[model samples]
Target: MFFGSRKGSEHNSGQDKVISMDRFRDGSSLSPIRQAEAYWTALRQGEDVPKRSQIDPRGLENILSQTFILERIAPGIARFRLAGQKLNEMAGMEVRGMPLTAFFTPTARKQVSAALEHMFDAPAVVELSLQTEATRNRPSQEARMLLMPLRSDLGDVSRALGVFVSEGNSMKTSQRFNVTATELRPVTPLLKPKMSPASKSPNEVNAGFAETQAKFSDEPSVMDEARALVEASRQSMDEARKSLSEIGKPTEKTKPSRSSHLRLVVSRD
Candidate 1:
């Protein structure tokens, strides 16, 4: 199922604005938009943004299929690495590997591209209110798109974590939306405190050590590499052992051929 896979909730009224800080703190609305926002907040914690490797689809199960992950392939260009079924249905195509601009109208593509760049360069979160042009065949739509920067595995701010929600009937044809309104919030990176030379706090040293370990441990690929190496070594040793074991194995003796003793004669007429 694509965009219309699930029946949207009644409260998804599509009229609600991005939740405010006060509303967020007071636990006001439980709309899909707010749910997406809260999940992104929890993932980041105190960091500038969460890393690509840190995201767990299971943790975002509620909105899992409504979310997307994009990677900046070049300046002013982003390709979708993962897209939800809703997005696919809206585009009327498989959206993964497609540029984000593909979903927007020609007139609004530049604006959409600029917003994407700002999300990466400012390392910020952006929320946009979107609407598709109405036609006899396709009805208008009201949608919300949230874009948040994410640290790539190589430590660059080139990945985007996004969630999209729309309140309306799904279109029969591909939909092209325009950004009606946008809100951007800049995020500050959390820096580690420096220790003075004279003080040389032991706690600071321990913290630094733990941080270094965490940097490497956060990527599961490292552990995968180690496991692969161990498995290869074990296989090699097993092969070597088999070769050694076969060296002195006894061999079966063959019976002498009776054909050697038999002679065949042919007489000519």
Candidate 2:
């Protein structure tokens, strides 16, 4: 379960440049913090954020459970949010259920965990900063974060849509950036979108059902709305004219399914 959801922007979308904040290169234009927000806005608008099912692995669900999509996934731990290519060369691995503390320098670990805790406890989108020693020998590195909550069918905080951005200056005469700061934000499950149900079965209320779902509505959070969507999805998938009257379309197909929250994935060397 990806904590934050969105797709990749591997293709040159020109949107990346919109958030680059080149003026920050001179330390004269934007604060690293502000730059991160601008970048996040661009990504959210570009529609480049990938969903959990598209990129992240299942083992991410454990620590992910304690967090909603509106919460931060933290800096050191393996993060499930699908981000852009700037982090491509980034390399690390995770052992399921491990707290992020085990993966960072002492100072980095302490500061980051606290910042993250505050973000989660409040259960709203918040901005926080942290220090890390994970860089290629940099003395001090700052990261910025944006944590926004997503809702499932239960009317509670379910997941989040997040964004992470690093700030830096362009190396003289080159395109390389020497990152000095980073930022993150949660975007989705914020404004509701039409829910796409995984599977549907009618007359089997206790049978396979949607674990999370929601209907399209404004001024509403989806966490509790998932139940309604599940029922609608059930009718849409298995019932004939009922759905046609609701959606003006005929039923497709409904199949039995179950939820798998976590699993291990091995790769061949």
Candidate 3:
């Protein structure tokens, strides 16, 4: 479920040197947003909300720095359990223990909070279109945010997995994103996967039959090899007895040879 990308490098004058901009793509074209969406979807498998344990950092290596995790502390409130480097760069500080709404502009804070509540309640995925504030030196920058519900170790819907990415230069200072647009997609756990008989493989179908046959088959085959060996042994013993009986019985004896009395008497002399 990994998306392929063609990466190109960009040189900056700041401390961040040799920045690699990877262009991820689906079947259509390169898109980091689509890559994030696909990654989130794969993590869920068939469940509505993926368990926090199911997440592996290596799986999202392409977007590792862009990912973060939030712990829902109360209703309509979530604090960061983990924040990635990309997010910290945007905030210009350590974001751990900070509210998720802290990254949003003041005007968009309420809407973003409401959306966070919906994400936990519906256990759905939320995608946000964000814009950074405009200033004389720094212009307005656009970004995308993806939030998906995650189940905590206590089996509560209080955790969320998220990814945030901006399509501009890295922010040197704290930047708040204004939620210009938001999309909420409802998701439900696949209750029962369709058990299609037509799709069953031959090995799978025979596995049950094999166990059943092994259980009910009590009759053992006759040992033909033993019988054949016993028969051959009996035949050999009969032939031996015949030869012994023949040897014991009287027969026409052959005459002794005339040369039997001859000997070399003076051989050693």
Best by TM-score: 3
Residue 45 miss distance in model 1 (angstroms) = 3.1
Candidate 3 per-residue lDDT, tens place, 94-205, comes to 9999999998888999999999999999877899999988999899999999898889889988898888887645656888889999999987765667767556644453
Off by over 4 Å in 3: 1-30, 168-171, 191-269
Displacement of the residue 64 alpha carbon in candidate 3, Å:
0.5
Query: What lDDT would candidate 2 get against the real structure?
Result: 0.41
Q: Candidate 1: list runs displaced more than 4 Å.
A: 1-29, 189-269
Cα displacement (Å) at residue 27, model 3: 14
lDDT of 2 by residue, 17-68 (tens): 3244455444534343354334334434334242322324232232222222
TM-score of 3: 0.60
Find the 10 residues in a row with the least total lDDT in model 2. Answer: 169-178
- 197: Cα error in model 3, Å: 8.6
Q: TM-score for every candidate vs. truth?
A: 0.58, 0.30, 0.60
Query: Relative to the unseen true structure, what is the C-alpha lDDT of residue 204 in candidate 1, on a scale of 0 to 100?
Result: 38
Clashing residue pairs in candidate 1 are: 3-86
